[model samples]
Target chain A: MNFVGRQAFRGPGLTFCRLLVARYSSKTGSKEYIDGLVKGKPVVVFMKGTPDQPRCGFSNAVVQILRFHGVENFDSVNVLEDEDVRQGIKEYTEWPTIPQIFMNGEFLGGCDIMMDMHKNGELIEELKKAGIRSALLEKAENKD
Target chain B: MGVPKEELEKKLRSELDPAHLEVDDQSDGCGAKYQVLIVSQKFDGVKPTIKRHRMVHGAIEEEMKSIHAIQLKTMTPEEWEKLKPS
Candidate 1:
């Protein structure tokens, strides 16, 4: 009897076992979990990597922009670790891209939108409306 | 597997009736990425950048599935006119 088939079977079986565990824990679904995460935070970014070591340029750009605006505290979810959460967030927000931003539980746009808003001074205004203060104004005032 | 730039342009044209539209295939022959600049009256009075993006994304939701990335710039006709050269 050949052991190759049994070895292959074992590999797949192990993977299946892990998948079952993931599914059970995520039973509430990624959408609900994502909603819960974004509900309380004034600013939440679902990005590809952690804030300090962003894996993607788009995600890095967002982090820098937020920092430039003086936003010191915000939640960041790294989607690279979980395939389900990565895909689930796209469906949850109806947005096809990563580095998505949510403000006050509302789906904000991606990096491009953030850059545009930042250029037009809309980002600062939106932060103010949400009761979050940015350091951009302080920098401008200090410069004057 | 990938959406053609022309197909995306057609969908946006029909839905938004943009006064000015430019769709560039940025995927370097893969046809998976695109950049669009659209100016339309429909965007008038649209507050916030996210809402405007959602309007554009809504118009091409089906095609979006096949697209890998979309860098979109949306503007009102008046804004477009201002940016236009004399």
Candidate 2:
């Protein structure tokens, strides 16, 4: 039984290891993943659908909020892009939801958490941490 | 919009292999809330913020969209007993 228990764990451990290796071996390697990701870039969102076509309200809300911030330097990836990365990211980031926000390579929590932080001014603080400062240019333009 | 509890329970147990599990259907009430209590070995080295919740969601990825808010109280059995020592 103990051996079975240990083997049960070893299975996933081995699986995770093989995934890591395969993740980096092909021409479509970690760099491609990184390139596809906005890790070192500005504000990047990995979402269910797209900013214009969010599959869920949660994704839409976050995208709308970012738009409100007048932060135009945003990039987005459709998590539905690759099924493996979509599922693997669930394991990789340990976040269950789409519309994951990353700022300069830092994980910035999920939609609800981000909404709370953005409501409380911490979103701007996090953005500052990533050297982002929102001028609300869109707000200004809309006003005019 | 709500899934049958028995089906959900069976699927969750089979998929996530939890050490503990609980489910409440509060869809008729405010927030469309469902309270889930689950403890899984998969969460042993995972972060507390969402480890158990995600495990459950992954197990029932299809249901999350329909169920509005799920109040999750995920813990190892050791922690579950401590928290619910009533």
Candidate 3:
């Protein structure tokens, strides 16, 4: 991850500089870059596209599931943009496949595990364990 | 070259010693993707689903490099028997 936050580019002339740095950093394989992104966010999804516009069905399913659980704010990295990061993440997690999910710097499995956890009510417990409160669970509790 | 379904079955059968195993090549003619169902004593104590997945992945780590995707359904013998229709 770039040490410079997006907020730092509020200056008039710095927007272009940020874009340049983004392009430059992605060319180099930086495990630190990946680590920084995962460590800083409570929930990190390394998927094919942004949460708003996922490039694949599996990625879209994960984004929708997170939304259904009322998790609105989370970090998403578009793996399609960077080849190094794409391959690097597979090696980093030792898991084959994209749309990987990490919570509190721990590897949770891909879409299949997410769906399984969601079905069994384990996902809500997982979110709470990571210090994220789920509105879905809250709604269920209120109905009781 | 992509991995063959028989190769994956042979690997999992030898490694996990599964009581039942079904390996389906879902990649059409390419043999690049697979859907596997395994029932074994090895999965009995594997707590989380992800760890169970890791055991399967580890069993076929070499073949996994050439394969595109693996959709796995792992169960202990008891769980497998419970899910059986008859």
Candidate 4:
């Protein structure tokens, strides 16, 4: 398993530095680079296209799942934008798929797992652990 | 060019020994896309979902190279039964 596991919580300044390295470093798609890309982010996805206009059905499904949870403003990497990243991510995670989701720097599974987790309420629990309160929780509370 | 459904099925059956398996080629004649459901003991017991997926992907590593997309539903028999019962 190439699972990166959960990283320790980081301060905003340290997170900013990691993001900067992820964005500006020439070694795009390297292990260190991807680590930086995901580190400290509440949610991140390496998908086929931008979240607004996902090129693939699976990627679009992931976008919808997060949206239903009222999760916006998450980081997204369009693999189509960079060939190195396109291949590098598959090798990095050793998982053969696009639309890979990460939560708190841990590689959550792909589209199917996202859907499964959403269905089983695990997604909400995960977001809560990341200190994100899902909008669904609010809706349920409002119903009560 | 995509892989033949039978070949993909055979590979997964042999590799994972799934209790229940369904491989659907959603790409019509071209065979580029697939939706696979595998219910197996291999997916059971404290295994994270990501690891379960990796097990399936690893089984079809070669076919995965040429395939454009795959939608996978991997679960242990107990999990599968809860979601879909006879």
Find the candidate with the highest TM-score and give its number: 4
Segments of candidate 2 deviating more than 4 angstroms:
A1-36, A136-144, B1-86
Q: On TM-score, who's better, 1 or 2?
A: 1
Better of 1 and 2 by DockQ: 1
lDDT for B77 (candidate 2): 65
Better structure of 2 and 3 per TM-score: 3
In model 1, what is the error at residue B9, expressed in angstroms? 1.6
Native RMSD of candidate 1 (Å): 8.6
Residue-wise lDDT of candidate 1 within A49-117, one digit each (tens)?
998899988899999999998886787777897787888888898888888999988887899999998
Candidate 4 chain B lDDT trough over 10 residues, lowest sum: B44-53
lDDT of 3 at A108: 93
Candidate 4 per-residue lDDT, tens place, B1-86, comes to 79999999999999999999999999995678999899999887846677888888889999998888898888898989898966
If you assessed candidate 4 against the hidden native complex, which CAPRI class would it receive?
A: medium
Q: How many backbone clashes does candidate 2 have?
A: 0
Candidate 4 residues A34-55, lDDT tens each? 8878888889999998888999
Model 2, C-alpha of A66: deviation from truth (Å): 0.9
Ten-residue stretch with the least lDDT total in model 1 chain B? B26-35
Model 3 residue A140 CA deviation (Å) reads: 1.2
Consecutive 10-residue window with the lowest summed lDDT within model 2 chain B = B26-35
Mark the regions of model 3 whose C-alpha exceeds 4 Å error after superposition. A1-22, A26-28
Backbone clash pairs for candidate 2 read: none
Candidate ranking under lDDT, highest first, comes to 4, 3, 1, 2
Q: What digit string (tens of lDDT, one per residue) describes model 1 on residues B53-86?
A: 8998888888888887788898999998888878
> What is candidate 4's CA lDDT for residue A63?
96
